[model samples]
Target: MKKPLIDMKNIRKTYANGSLEVEVLKGISLTIDQGEFVSIIGSSGSGKSTLMNIIGCLDTCSLGEYLLDSKDINSYTEKELAIVRNEKIGFIFQKFNLLAKLNCYENVELPLIYRCMETQERRERVLKSLEMVGLSDRLKHRPSEMSGGQQQRVAIARALACAPPLILADEPTGNLDSKSSNEIMNILIDLNRKGVTLVLITHDNDIAELAHRIIRISDGEITSSIDCKRGM
Candidate 1:
């Protein structure tokens, strides 16, 4: 069997006030294999966001182990974590985070800049990513010139431009209409079919149903994990 892409064991996170401490994650553990599409469903303040941040390497767990491709991340320094995030994970937010001034192609090209890829290589990747999302013709359009759905597509393209092994989307369809949400979900499913591992956080069951696996959280703990392939 292929090795898991992500292996998190007994993960825990806590925040502190002056005289009180709050535990956000209560020993959550999970393993996600390569090319798998998984959704985390929970209500607000359910620790879903904290878990996503940990998975994306944006934050660290206060305890337990997190291994990405067999490399333990708890020991990594801030700079190392930054490198890992840039090279191994792609992030999409509820708000389509795009630069207002840069055109679509330029926005997609931004991640590659940090990697210091040559100009030609960056251009090729940007174009290919844009084409993958059916936005090849909008390469020159700025964020303000596009609709919300188009902007989210641009965000996806930007995420893909890095060619990262894992994509972490936090409420990706939250800002779109039902039609646009369907379109975005279809694109995500297509990407998963093409072998990009996806981990998304959503409150909508309809959105979660699209994933092959669903993990539900409540009160900062994983309450259930359901494999949905039979239903699919």
Candidate 2:
């Protein structure tokens, strides 16, 4: 059988300041298969955000093993971790972290530039990703020139530009209104259907319910996990 896309075991995260130590993730063991849509749901002050950071390779776990794509991520050096982040995981943020000065196409092409892809290849990828997000016509427009939903779509395109196997979204709809949030969620659903493994962090149960599986966390521990019908 093929290995699971994500295989985390007893993952822990702790922060220390002076004489105080706070444990954020207390032994999280979860596995997600390729092409699955999983949502991590938690309230403010919970460890979902920290967990997302760990999964996205932006942070390391304090203890236990994390296997992303069957490789031990905790064993990697800082530079290797950075490379893993760029090559294996795609990130979408709540704030739509786009460059205000760059156009949509440019923003989408930034990852390819890091890979040193050829100009023609980057152009093809950028245009294809934007088209997937339904932003083909807005390629030349800047983030400041678009609405919140459009900006989020551009962010999605940027994430897709790398064609990573795993997509990690942290409160991707937090800054959007209801209509915009649904639109963004629909786009994510479409991507998952197309074989991208999706992991989303959200505080809203309604939003979490949209995913095929929901993992609930509370007080730095996994409280429950449920499989949904995925009415997509």
Candidate 3:
């Protein structure tokens, strides 16, 4: 049997509210297979973002067993988790998260630099990922020089440069117009077609339906996990 890329069992997250305690996740359990495209959908205050944070190793669940790539995530130290985040997960944020000072090429190459990749190899990856996003022509342009769509493309290129096993996209089209949203979705669909594992977090049902599987979350719990590939 092929082991799942992500496995979570009875995951929970709680936050302290001064004298009170609040639970954000209520014993959530899920799995994502390699090369699968899954969308997690929910409205605001649904704890969807918190779930994404745990999945990306950005935050730890208060209680649960999470095996990422067959390793126990809860057992890993913070530094080890940082390494895992860098090598195994690519993140696309709604805000783009590009540095104000860096140009396109520099921004895309940042992760590779953290990995201490050789100069020539870093050059190849930056160019290839930028080309994938149609941003190779804007290598020298800074974030201020581009529109929201273009900046999002640059962010996508940054995520791709690492060639990570999983991509975590959080409302990637939230900042874009209709045409730009479609274009970004097309790019993501193409990436999935080429065997990239993707987990998209969105509140829009229309966008969620685009994935191979749809998991609807509500009030810190998953209401449904549907295989929606047939609808495509």
Judging by lDDT against the true structure, name the best candidate. Answer: 3
Worst 10 residues of 2 by lDDT: 223-232
For residues 136-193, could you state the per-residue lDDT of candidate 2 as single tens digits? Answer: 9998999989999999999999889899999999989999999999999999999999
- Report the Cα lDDT for residue 81, model 3: 94
Lowest lDDT 10-mer window, candidate 1?
A: 223-232
Number of backbone collisions per candidate: 0, 0, 0
Whole-model Cα lDDT per candidate?
0.93, 0.92, 0.94
Q: What is the lDDT of candidate 2?
A: 0.92
Model 1: how far is 211 from its true place, Å?
0.7
Compared with the true structure, what per-residue lDDT tens digits does model 1 show for residues 1-232?
7579999999999999888989999999999999899999999999999999999999999999999989999999999999999999989899999999999999999989999999999999999999988999998999999999999999999999998999999999999999989889988898898989999999999789889899999998999999986236
Residue 133 miss distance in model 3 (angstroms):
0.8
Q: Residue pairs in steric clash, candidate 3? A: none
Taking all chains together, each candidate's TM-score versus the true structure is 0.97, 0.96, 0.97
